[model samples]
Target: MNTIEQQLWEYIDGDLDEFSKKAIEEKIKSDARIKVQYEELLKLNSAFSALDLDEPSMSFTRNVMESIALAPAPVAMKTKVDKKIIYAIGGFFIVSLLFLFGYSIYSSNLSMPKLDFNFNFNLDRYITPTVLYSFLFFDLVIGLVFLDQFLRKRINKEH
Candidate 1:
């Protein structure tokens, strides 16, 4: 936006600081151009204030009333779900996961599985620590970017 528009908006909104407001007021008083612009803004503001919002179409109320009439009568939708049971079920799942994870860790050496391939692909020529780390980093960054976009779209979605 232009500086004039910026100042005009700030002045209109009473957002200008005392010094800036005084400077603008002085400019408005001295320069006919500034004075005319100020007058135009004032007129526009007054016009907006005097204006009434556009009314809905004539059938709007009838449509709404008819829909309401056709709809089922208002009834509260109170939930009958038990909170304690939900909490208990959640607790059960958490405990089961923890137990299973602990058991797996305790019983395993966390060793890499030996791959017995029939053909020699010379995988060692391509697979290195740097390549692995780079791949992991790329995947992490892609995942993070995907997650960020998903969350941003979800958050900005209208209710």
Candidate 2:
């Protein structure tokens, strides 16, 4: 802002020192433009002072306080799982997986069992109903989890 405008605002806000005020008063008396601006500013200041501010309805504060009072107390949405159990399960899976992998690698160098001249081989030595059931159960759980995640993603995408 120009020095004159700054001085005028300072004067309007009652912030000017005596010497500054005198200087601005002299400038206003000598300069017609400054005097006109001063008059317009004075009119705006008076109009603003005369204007009444709007207030909310009488129940507004009470309603707000009441709504606040009526609001639910916050609680955690996610429950905490036992870290030890998670770690133990993870470690068990890792160790078992590593053992299976290492055993497969180690045993792969060994010879495969050959069928006799009679073309009879024992399948029971390699697989059992318990293993089959376990495998199916694992597959079912994995498929269900995958389907759950896929459906969740699809539903979320639709939304």
Best by lDDT: 2
Q: What are the models' TM-scores?
A: 0.34, 0.49
Candidate 1 residue pairs in clash (backbone atoms < 3 Å): none
Candidate 1 regions exceeding 4 Å error are 55-159
| Clash list (residue pairs), candidate 2 | none
Error (Å) of candidate 2 at residue 131 is 28
Candidate 1 residue lDDT tens string, 1-159: 778767976898899999999988888888998789878888888899999999999999999999999998889977565576567557656765875675465545554447543432444556567976885686577558656765776686644
Each model's total of backbone clashes: 0, 0
Please, what are the lDDT tens digits per residue for candidate 2 over residues 5-50? 8889889999999999898999999999999999998998899999
Model 2 stretches with alpha carbons more than 4 Å out: 1-3, 56-59, 79-93, 96-159
Model 1, clash count? 0
